[model samples]
Target chain A: MNQADSSTIVVKRTIAATVDELFDAWLDPDSLAQWMHPGTTALSTASVDARVGGAFEVLMHYPDKPLRHHGVYRQIERNRKLSFTWISDATQHSETLVTVEFNVASAGTEIVLTHERLPGQVACAEHTQGWTLAFELLADLAAKPLVLVTFDWVPEMPRGFVRDIRVRWALEEAGLPYRVQSVPFSDRNADHFSHQPFGQVPWLTDGDLSIFETGAILLHLGERSEALLPAGPRGRAETLEWLFAALNSVEMASLPWSLLQFSGNNDGTPGWNMMDSFLKKSRLAHLEPLLAKREWLAGPFSIADIVMADVLRLVDRFDGLADYPACRAYVARATARPAFLKAHADQMAHFAAAD
Target chain B: MNQADSSTIVVKRTIAATVDELFDAWLDPDSLAQWMHPGTTALSTASVDARVGGAFEVLMHYPDKPLRHHGVYRQIERNRKLSFTWISDATQHSETLVTVEFNVASAGTEIVLTHERLPGQVACAEHTQGWTLAFELLADLAAKPLVLVTFDWVPEMPRGFVRDIRVRWALEEAGLPYRVQSVPFSDRNADHFSHQPFGQVPWLTDGDLSIFETGAILLHLGERSEALLPAGPRGRAETLEWLFAALNSVEMASLPWSLLQFSGNNDGTPGWNMMDSFLKKSRLAHLEPLLAKREWLAGPFSIADIVMADVLRLVDRFDGLADYPACRAYVARATARPAFLKAHADQMAHFAAAD
Candidate 1:
């Protein structure tokens, strides 16, 4: 939320990093440079002394002009609060006070930013927008070192469809930077459970928060950018409902059926018959009409689409979606996105590299 | 986030209702009475006139003090913003300015409340806490009319373990108010798919957000209180990671195996053997040590416990936990909670009512 007046601006954001991690991101020159710019690829240059009276400077490489912002540390209460005197071209080259409070909250830090002694209403408004974009950049930058916990390699059978691909698709779509860390499929360790309880792969670690469950990972990543989840209400609601619909509603049944397909036995047995009917009637039949009506699950492509299309791709792989044209089309539409293609290729290469 | 100084108080919360719905919640006296009180069960009295220059009164019945808050609306922009002059005991009976801006966010409204012209620092601080508490109460009350979509009835085989029970357990634990809406199991309709794409019961409809996937619903309810998800970083992270573990990691394997058991066939087939081995080696074996070490999945019993215990209960029913005492004990510990017992009894009665 951003609230501005004639002389001050306040902004707050809930982030998935610890107070210590967040506090350091500000004072550490290298870290400060990563996300201090407007675009994900745009990196700033920063120098920090990081003491009570230390000096710090960040020069943002804007396309129009290189904007310079410099400040001196006014207060530092490690992991709790930080205050500095800020000066920038946008601030009329006059010093303004910026205080950041890092409140310990579930999953990360609740960062409250107060920029006081603004020149006037215009500066207040501009600074409000400036900090908002900076935080967005900061979030995108945080994704750079994100550790995506996944199986190093599996047999060719599940190569492209492994759950980690869902997280990959979202990250690629958002254009967030990340590197993959893998655990061999046949080897799971005690340390793995620390990241993922049931010992499955595709848990995401960002700063202090380690999130598992492919669905949960997708949901977590969805919060990072509007590309994964639209910031608008209607689209967001549709994306969420459909995201769950993908997991519980569609994949919930499709997954079991796909597993049976993989085993390639008991084709006409009682259990097979029941599961087959459930997937066709309870899952696919109900989903076909809805898919035929919408371009994506939501208005634009979203994290829900990534999850659902991924879920549907499995069914298509096993020929389970032979009868649903709309479902197949929806999958095609989603996978055609450059993000999905890149994610898929990277997953294949990751397994290949392990080999 | 709540930030206050001598002259102002600012509080913002991302809530799960439409801007229109949220805007009306402030001006509709009847709606205001439902959630304007501190406690979920405690109802306040409210009277409002929906226009600029109109007055509104809300008398909250506290344990000892019947605090009265009255305000005259200065500006009213439907579904956008509302500005008023507020007078209350907490503000030292001062006629302060309160402006509420409703921004359309993904799932609902991002409500920004700015209370300015406070009497002094004490008044500002007190009002900040007061507004935070009031917003918390509003969120709890919004859960009042939540409709839990579930099956009317199913056969005895899946009766005690319908997925809806997971949602019910969280609701009971959080002490949130809700009612069940039954969709007949055999009669799957388009209406059902609208709420649940897979036509599986247990999607939740909370105002504009109809979240499906038992996992997603639990996460949504988790946002309402600390009982479901603690507000601390570690507990919250554990709950999230484990909640997904139960769904994608544990249940992902258990459900298929359970379905085979339900059919009472393919006991020793290759597919059954593979599934059995997977359930034991990949899931339970890895889970036992972690479960044996901790009484609850998180620091305190959390929504993750609700999901994991329910998942384990099903596997236990099939005699799957025979060799895993730790998993068995963990399930028992979770089920032994009063909230779990109430949720179980109510689920049983709900099915029996259909009969």
Candidate 2:
């Protein structure tokens, strides 16, 4: 009847590594500077305090931005556990808790991390989904000899519409030989549901494992090929930040724009008007400045570009993106890659076959 | 246009280490084991494919539950970028992406990570928020000699209500010195807005960094202490899973339960009985089994406990939780903490003064 019985979310991960090795990396600040961030810039400052009730901080600076993130430690439990509070001075939002646990397993070490107690339901659900994706990426990056796998499905393929361009491009950019698993929209049914939770095409499988979400699959592959992300802690952190901006900041603005076009109504309904207004304002206020300088969101052709380009591409379906020349040029550069072309062709063929 | 234009969420972090020293820890499977999981069990079955178009996988097993997580690599860009997909085969509905980028920053390597395209808006926001907290935790764990800082505030302290016990307990657990920042409910001025985008209380700061969300702040502290998270990757992952479940799954289910009791007032109206019955059934069905399991939601004392305790506490306030012994016990343990007591006392005193 203790307080432990009522929790709902549980996170558990097992990695193949010895406990001592894992503990050393966690305890030593030097080791953290390595894999902490997968893509983007690099770490500018990192300091540690490992004793109980001690405090610590890490500052990650982006070469392309004026912002710096500072994280402070709350608790330290040697090799067994680590806990801390997270905050972004730039945003001034309430901090969140992150707890990491380590133990020994037959194969190696098992890591358990719990980030809990977001302010609201919306925030909680969002973090749950995002963390799930990030963990997958971590596992793939940690894997050895890197494995790359890809699948191809077209937008108009099979009996319905599918968005397979993302996976195709990911495979192409990573230089992985992939196969096509196209399904007509008409045939996407219970069988598909069993394989893909969302009942969508462009699902990917590596060995016996299967993934449905496009972004998740792409990140997984990026870990294997190291082609979609940057190398270094600060770089990786920056890459992750862009990923969030793509999904949250940029994507949030794009939704209404897409919805307005999809609905195909110009009426000034309360919701529609609100959406349109939001889209217009957000684009001018946030996105315009974001694209004013950088050729890429982070630096190189990381998955951040892939995500932004995909979302931005959808904007072209509705409002021609000519007004945002920077965004347009960025998209053009991203799609101009040979690998992107191959992936696009493969996806188009799948859809054409459906026709 | 400057670097800030290209990047919005960049930070300047300086560390002392060569690129090879940092990169090796992430690339070498053995080195990864050291810091991969800070709190729980060590990693098991770690493998990597460092080349482009390679494959990678990591498997983690949970000792107390029949759960295992598999992370698959999707792309890798050698000492540069890594992406992967995470999946929980047992859940059948779990899919996520994680991208990590590595780069050189000053004398050390910077890592940027992006987890893109979560399931939905709610999921995306929550995950992004969670990452901020987790990053703080990671930073703290990396820093050995830590200096902890924290803050406490009540939800409706301005109106003489104190419900932010969790924040206080977290601070106490980490044994950090802190101060209180009070806000009035009626104060909707720019000052409040500057501190909290959502105008909520329980905001915190660490040196120049500030955080507004309670959950995020807790995680930031937890990462520094490593006391709240289990050891090992598997354990760490599982802990994170529970953190999500507590925040989204169980907490979401409890919402209806609370609304039914306090906001129900059927009056035999249309959809009244249906709504009430639905809420009752949903709440019971979701919680009964969760209570039947082990003492804690994930294991031992963790952030999941803090989150679930808060959620259940809310439920109890509306309708006494006498029926659910496990849940009730869970609440009792959380409230019994000395930090919780101090927070409650301080909140009460603040409210009393306001009155």
Candidate 3:
């Protein structure tokens, strides 16, 4: 980038992507097709030769007409940097030097794009605008790099009920990319509360959208893929209603009820009797009939089932669901889901590591 | 219903609407514009004279072109029946007799729509389907006839924490039509459990769709209108995440802590100490920053605010918000909304009546 030359322009973006991932997006045709085009243009079709001296053509489909840009790779240093010659009609059909550097940054990877030796000031400005628009879309590549926030460790009693398992289950179900970050269970600080107001485990960060609460995070992930949430109006409605049901309805009883069981406080105290009666009469009894009739709560397998099954799973752990065969069966069926199994195992491993 | 005659057809539906509301839907032009369509047509431009022997014309916008269906009121019986002369292109441009009876039934207002003097079998079949389609939309009248089921009464300690206030607050915020139904607090039978799995009160019935759990019910109501929820993606995403944060994150700590207060159990016991530590450290301290920064949890007022405020209200009842001014102000800000005031008053009244 020549700061003194008015004919050259540079743009930089710090993307939440790994070094290799950001570097590869520029060379892969499929990846290029997703983010290479200017904001005004439709999808760009590209074919890349990848190595040095290899030629590439990207045809961007605008509403009015198609524009083709051809370039030759001058240098390729794997994840480090790439320098190429870019020739387009906007550049007066002249060859220009384009370099992209993927630098390892504290947050993620920062990409510095330089386009030099433009036709004049206008071409430089156009290329700058074009690259800026492309970067806006390129930022989407970072959106998938989710951070699942939860406690570092908890006791055996709250193992499955640690709640992060719900989010892990959802991320797995959606086939999303996420990494778990644990906070200190014994010592929570002001920083932790900023992300999760309740200082609870299982908050999630998707790009800048940091959301706490298991149900909220599940919903956030559910919106990412139909595997977690359906797209249609009817199915979406059912999924939303049922997902809330698992947390607000089923878990409202199950959580406190499970805690009592954990403490062995069910020695027929008033608190114990109140919780037990409510669990047996209010929750499990109603769940039995509904579970008996349906394979899943909503029309298909969805995030709603993930929450509902997890809520009932806690009760079944304490042998609370013994009489409710359908509820028991439903729990077994949902836990048997490959994603649930993976999420559960992952959560157990996360805690074991902390221990 | 005209069971004996094949030429005459009758369609009946038990709509969860008041007799007066059902009868009014037939006479009102705005109401006609809502549901009076052939299932394929767009919004209907309706102009109704309403009185006996008065005319009405509904111009339905179909994909291809516009269609005009005209009618004259032959009889007007307020809440009882509506007899009119129906004519359209499908009726061979010939006049037909249509009578609608709104009878009070055990479940709701049952509407019997009978059409006679059709041109032929094809015309009869077409009108049968058209009216049936109209009824399908008319059945939506029942959708607003929400039945909020909760406990009849509880002690003063559990008065404001009854949970139904969440749904009631949502309903009022949305300005939706609903009625409250009470189940026995002491005795929750098999019948009560049918609607709610945890035999909990506060399960909601929206026509045929019954959803239990305060969060689920609020979401269900939020979907009905943007008043309790935003329609835009960003706003909705914030609403959903914050709502779950309120319940699963904030209330997860507050509920148990409040229970300990209700029992006056502050003896430094392990359970009591654990609940206390979590409420102050994990929840309120974290919530203070967010409440201080934002006027509402989402971009605008939403169901998320309702749940969050209500959760804090319980804590405030026990002087829990004394240390956190932001959390206290947030609760005050939310409860000051007219809907919350009405819901709280009505809940108190309902329990008081039972007492």
Writing each residue's lDDT as its tens digit, candidate 1 over B270-349 gives 66777787788989998899888988877888888998899999999989999999999999888999888877866775
Q: Give candidate 3 misplaced runs (Cα > 4 Å).
A: A1-162, A177-191, A231-235, A257-281, A288-293, A315-326, A348-355, B1-161, B177-192, B263-268, B350-355
Q: Report the Cα RMSD per candidate.
A: 23.3, 32.4, 18.6
- Say which prediction, candidate 1 or candidate 2, comes out ahead on lDDT: 1
Shift in Å, residue B151, candidate 2:
14
Please write out the lDDT profile of model 1 over residues A1-355, one tens digit for every residue: 2453578889888787777767877875545765677665444666777789988888787767778899999999999999999999888988999999999989678889999988999888888887898887666555466767688679988899888899989988987776566676887787886777666778888777877787777767777788888777556667777776677556757777787788886378777777788788877887789889989877888888888899999999988888999999999999999888867866776675455
Q: In model 1, what is the error at residue A119, expressed in angstroms? A: 56
Over B256-282, each residue of candidate 3 has an lDDT whose tens digit, in order, gives 677667766554655565557768876
- Error in Å for residue B286 of model 1: 1.2
Chain B TM-score in each of the candidates: 0.60, 0.50, 0.61
Residue A196 lDDT in candidate 1 = 72
Which of candidates 2 and 3 reaches a greater DockQ? Answer: 3
User: Lowest-lDDT window of 10 residues in candidate 2 chain A?
Assistant: A152-161
lDDT of 2 by residue, A1-355 (tens): 1123232234666766556655555444433332343232333233456665554454444666533433556666666887776554422466766777888888777877776545555555555564565455445434433222222223331211134677767777877644443344555666665444334455665655555545456556666666886666445545644554464345555644464456463345443444455455544334555677778877777877887788787776566475777777777887888877755654444344233
- The list of candidate 2 runs beyond 4 A from truth reads A1-164, A176-215, A320-322, B1-355
Clash pairs, candidate 1, are A152-A183
The estimated TM-scores of all candidates read 0.60, 0.38, 0.58
Candidate 3 lDDT by residue in tens digits, A153-175? 79876886788888888887887
